[model samples]
Target: MAAGAPRIFVSHLSGIAVFDPAGDQVGRVRDLVVMLRVGQRPPRLLGLVVELATRRRIFLPMTRVTAIQSGQVITTGVLNVRRFEQRPTERLVFGELLDRRVTLTETGEEVSVLDLSVHQLPARREWEIDRVFVRKGRKGSAFRRAKGEALTVEWTAVTGFSLEEQGQGAESLLATFEQLRPADLANVLHHLSPKRRAEVAAALDDDRLADVLEELPEDDQIEILGKLKEERAADVLEAMDPDDAADLLGELPTDDQERLLRLMQPGDAADMRRLMSYEDRTAGGLMTTEPIVLRPDATVADALARVRNADLSPALAAQVYVCRPPDETPTGKYLGTVHFQRLLREPPPSLVSSILDSDLQPLDPEAELPAIAGFFATYDMVAAPVVDEAGSLLGAVTVDDVLDHMLPEDWRETEFHLDEEVATDGS
Candidate 1:
């Protein structure tokens, strides 16, 4: 970059006014776009994402950016009127990247990344990330942050956590995206080119990969799973919610299904085998083998701990199954379930059996989809237990799984538009 090129924190750039040459006001900065290249070098700044008064958004290339002054950005590129859709090679700094957390390699301390600064490349119109601002303290409300702890550091000093590291490939991307929720991560991944998506899928740990897989479309699920080595693929499937894993596995050809199943842990393989045996339209097919199950004598505190697992879905976490001896499902005798509402009302020292909803009958393993839907509707339950004729708890069907099966077959391919107001960096 030129020795004296203007350098400013990204926050200062955000919301700055943009004008075309001749000083005609155009729009305001919504975010900055950068293309992550290969290796340790800083990513090249591509352009700015601007939101016009009409609420439409568009990309303004860097070549057109003549100067960036306090409160204003000047551009010479003709603005395209089309709505902004992020391309695979591009990432939005303010929208999804600003103020995320990262580990400083030199100090081994984790800090919240506050902003980044860019400068023009010497003799070239291109811009690149030059500095990173950070803060150390507690996180508060989603939007508001703690103050008086901020500092600036050279970007290279921050290591092991960035999606923008040029040559590091998937590892860099995973580090860069540590803070993204599974759904948001899925959205980002869905927009990636096939090669980038495959790299990310292969790099993610089994649990993280499993979570992202659940949010993706079936075709995406198939494509990503197909990219993993057979052993790792089986591991990820085993980590997934049983119902979701079953659904994805069912979509694969018989040969691939059998091969992957063979690589799974025996118990997990057995559970999947049982779930696969049922038609997708039936209760057996829709239920998840993993649920918060507690022995009748287990305390409310114990039940609460199980539900507190961060990985559990909202619906699955809403209740706990209180079963007789043998807590493992499919063999555990079905007693009844205790809703989270009832648990909180009871004393923590109370036994789970004291709060059991004994009268809430479980669904039959063979119950059809309509019956499953009606059960959820009739009882006003977020989830319902499934049981064999022998009264053994088979699994539990969550509302999300039921809706997945009930929704239109092509629902996954449907496109969605972002709402008007945007939150910076998913904050």
Candidate 2:
């Protein structure tokens, strides 16, 4: 609690009150603002915004902070209501910083730096600070002034930052393009210029290159496929969804497609061929071969035990599908689905069959999109079992996968932000 003694982690700085020399509580520290420049190691402190009663706010420079103490903070000076100049929070956005100039301090001299990009890491991954990069400017005499000057810093030095992206550079843009999930990648591919997109894809690592290929639009896939090394292209196509692979291959020049397919692993090639055999819009084509199925007679406890051991994909529905063994299928009958939540609520040893919702609807391989959409909309199902004419389970169509097919091209970017506590300065 003593001033200048060991303080808590920066992440826990919010809500602690600000106090003057007399220990009178003035306001609560609200936000810590840092000014960033591209490629710099440390960003300059813009200031702190202190929220007070009557909707009043005060801005204090970093230098004014004296020491963080128990219950309150000590400041070098007090803020008077009449003298304070209040304004809405100003944030520099990405578009505004593109090709802009920023100031940087070197040896106490100020210089202009070429702003390159700004990246905001999400709050969840708050180990590093948000950073912006700039090309170092030439040294000049104008930098040293009477006192304070503006400057930018790099991302490498800061402890943590916002997940929301503000300013972006070509390099950061490519980085975002690489890390985004498949559906997101697909949506944004159209936003960048074709040349820029190709450049981004070319710069990607193997895993990321494969992911981007899997998500690209059909036309873009063909365009990029031709550009990739033959072997590399084959590897990516092999890793992609079968239907996606087949569609892309179908778009390639006949000779190139044949060569690529021949180069792919035998098993992967077969899967692609099988999917290509089906109508492009059919359930057989859209469904993933992997399914999490449990015997109709298994207990909830036993099913959960298996769930714990299985290497299931995150895309799958949590609910496990109940099915008759392949041997007993035609002779037996359609069972039902065991909802995952129900297992958690019911005591162990509850028979999965006892909890089975026999009213569970099923879809056929040849089912239409509208029928699939209707089933998903009506039941609020996360995944539905795809069955044959004889009620034999084939695969499943997950809710997320279906949405990928149905959702709009552009949605919100995955914004990152540190927790309020983590983003603030101490009292």
Candidate 3:
């Protein structure tokens, strides 16, 4: 759903068929998962518990969902088959919330929940329960419909659903830090005891956990990964950036690495193996296999659309790689680069190949850390493409990855504090 989409009542979504991009039904939504926040803030609609044809229930993340229409939910077709497990922080809308009695904040009168309405935030993928459909006088039973006034109220107009501000446990801790960036959240997780860290990690969604794991130290990453079930660990690894996932796998024992790789999707496993084949500090190892790749004839409009992806890092989005036939990594003969600034200046319909910066030399797959860093410094580039001896576009290395390798091993452990006075003056 886009900005200003009409709010959908949870009752309407019940038992809705879930379809893939191909329009084939994959499953039906059994329930919605939400994480309650501290205080009366609306709970975030995390994802859905989808029941497949085999009677197997799995988690379908909202990130993978493309649209929720009248009777069906359309997904990006990337479904993780692992069984859904409710964490300490997750609440099931169907099983826990509906038909429950809660108080109205305005009149202090108790109301029975009939249904809840959720809306996707404008310009964002996140959805939240924003309204409540309730009965005023009495709770309705399965066999009896009590005579009572029925009405809808804003989510904030009710109480008793959200977590308490002074609540303890990982649920409260997670709620408190829900808005923190992955790096800042990783820092917080780093300071926690191993048990607390594991609890918090388990409470986080796979995509979120993957982002935080990429920012954490190697030891922490290994420890947290070890604590999760093998299936879940594999899912989280698949969610991580290819290079980062490969780097983490490289730290594990050979047998453990092989086990996780076997559990991942074939395409992801292949990318991991390819990345792992490279020397740790080389261009191939540092590069992400999923950089935006466009064919020679792609237009400026196409390039801009790819760059606008919310999942892409600013460094990776700084430019796009133009290649031949195959658009994926290990693409057909590398053409050249098209910087973001150049894309913006060109007419939307203009061919990207026409404005390609072919003069800038791309890095060789075996280029070492020092040489790769030198290329970035000399070219003043945030990212540089990597090509194999055959001239196939392998992947692209961003300046951030270069810095990650150049920094001391214990650099992540160092605590940096900003002085309030200095920050005030600077601002």
Candidate 4:
């Protein structure tokens, strides 16, 4: 849902038909899964449990959901068919929350939860249960009921759904550090005991866990991946960057790698296999397969839109690779590059081909670490496209990936106190 979209009551969502981007019905909404915070703060709407045509239920993350209107849910068409599994921190809106009595913070009068109103936070994809619809009455039995008064209140007006302050499970721990960056959270996980680490890892959502896993050491990555069910492990691996996922898969036994690869989407599996075919420190292995690729005929406006994606790393967004037909890497014949700055200066209607920077040679897929580093240094480029001998655009290598290969193996283990005080006057 877009920012400022109408709030939807959970009652209205239950049993609603769900459709993919192509307008084909995929499933029906089964339930909403949310994570309760430590206090009366609103719970984050994780996603929906959807029952497919085959009667198998799957989790549809809100990130993949594009619209909820006219009594139907629309998705991005990338549904994960794996069965929905509720974590320790998750709560089912209809199954568990509704009909339960929670006390109003001011009156101490208990009210039954009739429904919940969820709204997408402005400028963010995250949604939350921001309002509560409740009936002020004595507890009602399954068949008989006492309905005194019905009213709506802010989520904070009630108590009892939030986690206890003294809670010690991974749920509480996750709520405490919910705002930390993945790398910072990975550092926190690194110091935890093995049991605690696994608990925390399992509790995290797939996208989040994938990011944290990328920052964690190899042993931790393998250990945590092993503890998860194989289906879930494959899901997490698919969520990771293609290059990082391939690197992690390379650390596993070949049999184990193939099994997980078989579980992934065919295209993602293909990318992993292609990436793994190269030496670890080579350009092909270090580059991400999902860089922004635009056709020669695309306009400056088109390139800018792709660059503006919130998910793209700064380095990846630094420039766009203009290519022939077949935009996805390994794309059609390599054309040239269009830096973000040049796009801004060009008129929106101007074709990307007109402003191409073709003079700079693209990196070969087999380029070694030292050569790749020298190319970045000489060209002052944050990212450079990688092409095969046949001039097909393979992927783009960013400066960060080059540095990762150049750094000492134990560099991630070294502690740097970014918060340490610095002398102001050369004292």
TM-score comparison, 1 vs 3, better candidate:
1
TM-score of each: 0.67, 0.49, 0.60, 0.60
Runs with alpha carbons beyond 4 Å of true place in candidate 2: 1-182, 185-189, 253-257, 295-315, 323-335, 347-354, 400-427
Model 1 C-alpha lDDT per residue in residues 1-427, reported as the tens digit of each score: 2347678777677556888777777878766899866665787889887766554567788887778875798776466666668887777775445545667768877666667888887788888887888777653322243554778888777764445432223432454456767875786577555766776676677898999999998889999999888999999999998888988999999999999999999999999999999988899999999888888889999988898998888999999887776777775688889999888888999998887899988999899999999999999989999999888888999998888888887555443354434422200
User: Which residue window of length 10 is worst by lDDT in model 2?
Assistant: 139-148
Query: Residue 345 of model 1: what lDDT?
Result: 89
Q: In model 1, what lDDT does residue 19 have?
A: 81
Compose the digit string of candidate 4's lDDT tens values, residues 1-427: 7888889988778668898877788878867899999866899999998866555557889998889999999888877776567788898675556655688999999777777899999999899999988888775542344568999999999997652322112543454456667876786576555766776787788999999998988899999999889999999999998999999999999999999999999999999999999999999999999999999999999999999998888999999999897989999999999999999999999999999999999999899999999999999999999999999999999998888788777666653432223211110
The true-versus-predicted C-alpha distance at residue 134 of model 2, in Å, is 9.6
Alpha-carbon runs more than 4 Å astray in model 1: 1-168, 410-427
Q: Estimate, for each residue in 84-196, the C-alpha lDDT of model 3 and write its tens digit.
A: 67898988775557655789998999877778899999889999999998878864432345567989999999997653322112433454355667976786577555765
Each candidate: RMSD: 10.1, 13.8, 16.9, 17.0
Query: What pairs collide in candidate 3?
Result: none
Q: Order of all candidates by lDDT, from best down to worst? A: 3, 4, 1, 2
Could you tell me which 10 consecutive residues in candidate 1 have the lowest summed lDDT? 418-427
lDDT of each: 0.78, 0.55, 0.84, 0.83
Task: State the lDDT at 43 in candidate 2.
Answer: 46
Positional deviation of 339 in candidate 1, in angstroms?
A: 0.9
- Which residue pairs in candidate 1 collide? 1-122, 37-166, 38-166, 38-167, 39-166, 39-167, 163-176
Prediction 1 global C-alpha lDDT: 0.78
Residue-level error in angstroms, candidate 1, position 244: 1.0
Q: Which candidate, 2 or 4, would have the higher TM-score against the true structure?
A: 4
Worst 10 residues of 4 by lDDT: 418-427
**Model 2 C-alpha lDDT per residue in residues 148-210, reported as the tens digit of each score:** 343445535322232232222233333323344554555445334465455546555556666
